[model samples]
Target: MASLFQRRRNKATQVERVRERRHEGFLRYAGFRWAKISASLCLLVIVSYALVDVTPRHNGGSWYGYTLGTIGAGLILWLTALGYRKRKMTSDHWSLKAWTSAHVYLGLSLIVIGTWHTGFQLGWNVHTLAWALMMLVILSGLYGVVVYATLPAALSNNRDEMTQMQMLEAIRAFDRQLHTAAQPLTPEDTAPVLAALDEDPFAGGIGARLSGRYPDCATAAAHRALSASRSSDAEAREKVVGLLSQKQAALGRLRQHLRIRALLEIWLYVHVPLTFALIAALSAHIVSVFFYW
Candidate 1:
């Protein structure tokens, strides 16, 4: 009986430990294990690059350069495996969080590995092109890391305890109220209300979403025009204007939410394509090296 109780308690403690590790952020995974490893790798490469006496100085064709190139190429392929790794699940050391931590740090280490591979000998060739593409991919990845780390809090605060669907419903409710309130107004006054109702909440495209600017938004225009009205049914106009104002505020919050999401996701649009391009350039580079030799 005592043995059974001890076994159950140990099992419960193990489950709790797994739960705590699961909630920890990837950057701090295993207490920055990947960061330390990547830094050490870079330091070793830099020291080797400085100490090794490559005959006729260093260039991509040198023996030392070949070693760095091999390391960089392998690292790139491993880093790219992260996309596939995301589809798999595990709770041990090779979990998704650990894979991501390694991906980020190792990816950054390419700056050192790749630059040393070139041996400071850049030019207008496929070799240079591969290096440039790699740099671009890294820069975009860095942007992705920054936004993921910082913008999520802003996104949560903007949500204000409302689901996206709820926010849209709130806008629609205001629109219904505006429609009923405008019924007593003249045709001229009703025109703006109609325009506001007709406007699409998401019509501005990617640029507008990212910028959070809708200079020609019909709802905003309607609100302004109705607020300035001197019609005899001023009370009705005021009511419609008030509804428009509420709808406008709702739209602002929705757009702000979208802007943050866009910023969060736009890097992938750049990063993924550039990564493929880098691979192609890298392939070409390797082939040319062997072909010329």
Candidate 2:
């Protein structure tokens, strides 16, 4: 019976070992090789552009320069297509992470090829506009990358697994506690607290939301009022003050959440509008090149 049991255990362990090896092999081929190929291709493009010199003629466009520029522009457009195509592809087939890795490296390759295509010329033309827009888009995308990489961890820590709703609710609960604590205050003492509660938290217009500077925020006003008020009952005043302090802390957390969320969202405003402008500029550039020259 002991020998039988030992034999079963050995077989189970061997099967597990085989599965582990297979998993590692799959990851090696699919994961590492994908990154390796992307890196190698990007290097090849960069090196080729660096080694080749196709300076533009002074009077007219050189056929060689035109060809290089066309190829480079085609690659840029192709890279853009890859971004959209990768979005549509299944994760099992090609992971979004791998696609993004390829996108970043290949996008970097464009800078080398694009500069070579330009021959380092800048002018007030559609060509220049297109190039400027492309740079803007690339820079904004880089901003997004940085924000995603760094802020997400900070956001998670700030949230502590709580949703935004939960955070707001916590703030409101603290406010309720403050309200109860403030009840014992004389009419004169309670006047500011009442005024604070009367003001709207979300009444600020679009400008205030975008600026993130809410001068009329009830929480801030209440803090100031609590600081300035003079009361005879030291112990009661201290208790009320402590509650106000807790409410202020909770309000700070809520505001931090709003600030971070706003920062994350604000970039999209620049990025999306610029992307549309780039598309239009690129179209105009292609049309002007073919029509005039």
Candidate 3:
């Protein structure tokens, strides 16, 4: 019975190790403690909004509005400080994970706070513009949460245990094979092969990265050309065609990997820039409200 118990413990440890290896990530960190906090904060703000009865149509100038506004503004500053918090590494309780967990939850809470600050009254003013930008930033952060949770799995599956450098190296090896194999082909057939070899793998920029659709893939063109040309000479065409197929398949995996990675990371480009923009718009909103006051 003791031996059986030990074996079960060992098996459980092995399973846990395997799970850790795949690595889902931080969005669901600590059993979604942050998500719960965010939900509760939102609920509290919303409940308070419904319960508190204010005059002058319940706008931003109210006392409760000022309280919510104070909290929201402080939240915006604190959430933005995550950029700075991330730069310094720490090992104790105030680790990056703790900071990020707080960032996500508290950032989410701001949605309620900011909305309540307006007393659910929106207008065509700098205040509304700031709120819009803040919403955009938060939406982008939520996108980050989604991609972070899901894309890592897809990325791992696509990689098949290969590293980024290894993927690039595999492409290089395929190119070399394609080049050597294509040398004997006729000039017309060789045009597409040369184009395939000559084209930069990283050429397509943001559109290609995002879409993962390389319509003008020289390797694909060469494969199509060679597939047709296979009728001319069975053996030689087969070799070149096979190599092109290999190259195309490898490129597809690479592109898929890149696309997943880009999806995982691309939200930051939207989130960070808009964070600054939100802060600036928020500053303008505050200044306009006070300057007019």
Candidate number achieving the greatest lDDT relative to the actual structure: 1
Each prediction's RMSD over C-alphas, in Å, is 3.2, 5.5, 3.7
lDDT of each: 0.92, 0.67, 0.84
Give model 3's TM-score versus the native structure. 0.87
Residue-level lDDT tens digits of model 3 in 150-213: 7878999999999888888988998888788877778878888899998788778889999999
lDDT of 2 by residue, 110-131 (tens): 5655555566677888888888
lDDT of 3: 0.84
Model 2 regions more than 4 Å off = 1-60, 78-89, 199-216
Q: List the residue pairs that clash in candidate 2.
A: none
Candidate 3 Cα outliers beyond 4 Å, as residue runs: 1-25, 230-232
Q: Residue 41 of model 2: what lDDT?
A: 58
Cα deviation at 113, candidate 3, in Å, is 1.1
Q: lDDT, candidate 1, residue 58?
A: 91
TM-score of each: 0.92, 0.76, 0.87
Better of 2 and 3 by TM-score: 3
Could you give me the TM-score of model 2 versus the true structure? Answer: 0.76
